[model samples]
Target: MDPISLILGAILVGAAKGSGDVASGAVVDAYNGFREALRRRLAGRKPAQTAVEEYTADPDNWRPALETYLQQADAQKDEELLASASAVLSAADPDGASHGKYAVQIYGAQGVQVGDRNIQTNNYRSGP
Candidate 1:
C-alpha cells in the first residue's frame, strides 16, 4: 500500500531472515544493505534512529513513532534506501507474489485491483 507500510514490512521481513540460523549470505547482505541505508538516512536524527531500533524490538508498539520519522526523512523517496529494502525483500521472499500466506475474497466488486503500481480505468456504459 503506502510507502511507510512497505518499508516497515521490508524491515520485519529482513529482521526475520536475519534471525534465522540458516540465512543465505545473499539475504544477510541484502538485509545489512537495507539497514545501513536506513541508518545513513537517519544519521543525524537521534529520534529517528531510536525509533528504528525500538521498532525492530516491538514493531506494533513503535510503529507510529517509526512511521513519523520515516515520513519526516522522506524515506519513501529515497531511491537507494528503497532499492536496498527491495533487495532484502527479494532475497527473503523470492516468489514476489505470494509467500504461501494469503487468503483474499472479494465479493460484489467492480474494477477490482490488487497489489501495487496498479492502474484500473473502469468505464461502465449503458447498452443493450
Candidate 2:
C-alpha cells in the first residue's frame, strides 16, 4: 500500500479501537506493529515516544497525539519515516484496503465531504 493510504488506514484502525471497536487478534497485532513502528521512528525522542505509548495504551484518548505526530511527519517531509510507518500500517490492515485500490477518485459533478475521516474506494466508476 502507498504511504498515505497506509497511514490513513492506521489512523482509521486506531480511531476504531478508540471507539471500542475490537477485531481479531491479528488486527490487534497489526495495531501493535503500527505502534512499534511509530516508536522506532520516534526513538530517542522522549516526548514523542511518550505520546506514542499513551496512544498505544489508550488509543481513543490519545488518538489526537497520533494525528499530531502524523501531521508533523508530513509537515517535515519525513519521507523515510512516512514510508516506514506506511509499510507497518499496511501490514496491519489485513484486508489490504489500504493499498489505495479506489482512494480519492472524485467523479462527475457531485460534491463530497468526508469530515474528519478516511474513505477508501474501489472501482468508483461514476457519480450522480
Candidate 3:
C-alpha cells in the first residue's frame, strides 16, 4: 500500500475509535470564540488581539454566551452529542474489542474477513 494510504487509513481508524468528551466543550468554546473574532474583524475591529484577549481574560464570562450561541446554532443534535460521548467511552476501553469491533464490522461488511489464522493476507491476493 502507498504510504499516504497507510497514514490515511490509520487516521480513519483512529477517528472511528473516538476520543473522550473532556475536550469537546473546549473545542466548542474555541470554535465560538474564533467565529466571534471573525465577526468582529469583518466589522472593522481588531479581533485576534481584542476578542482573544477578552475571551482569555474571563473564560467563565464567555462560557454562558458560547453555550447560548451553540443552542441557537442548531448545528448539532442531542443524539449526535450522546453518540459522541458513547464513542468516547467505548474507545477508552483497554480491550481492542470496544473500538476495534466497529472497524471489524465495517471490514466484514466490505467482504474483508479475518479468520482464526494469524496471517494478514487479503482474499483478493493473486496466486500462481
Highest TM-score model number: 1
RMSD of 3: 17.9
Better of 2 and 3 by TM-score: 2
Per-residue CA lDDT of model 3 for 68-92, tens digit only, reads: 4434433124334323333333343
**Candidate 2 lDDT (Cα, 0 to 1):** 0.53
Better of 1 and 2 by lDDT: 1
* Model 1: worst 10 consecutive residues (lDDT sum): 97-106
Per-residue lDDT for 75 in model 3? 19
* Residues 70-98, model 2: lDDT tens digits: 56655225555555444444444535445
Minimal lDDT window, size 10, model 3: 1-10
Each model's TM-score?
0.72, 0.44, 0.23
Each prediction's whole-model lDDT (CA): 0.77, 0.53, 0.35
Report the backbone clash tally of model 2.
1
Residue pairs whose backbone atoms clash in candidate 2: 102-121
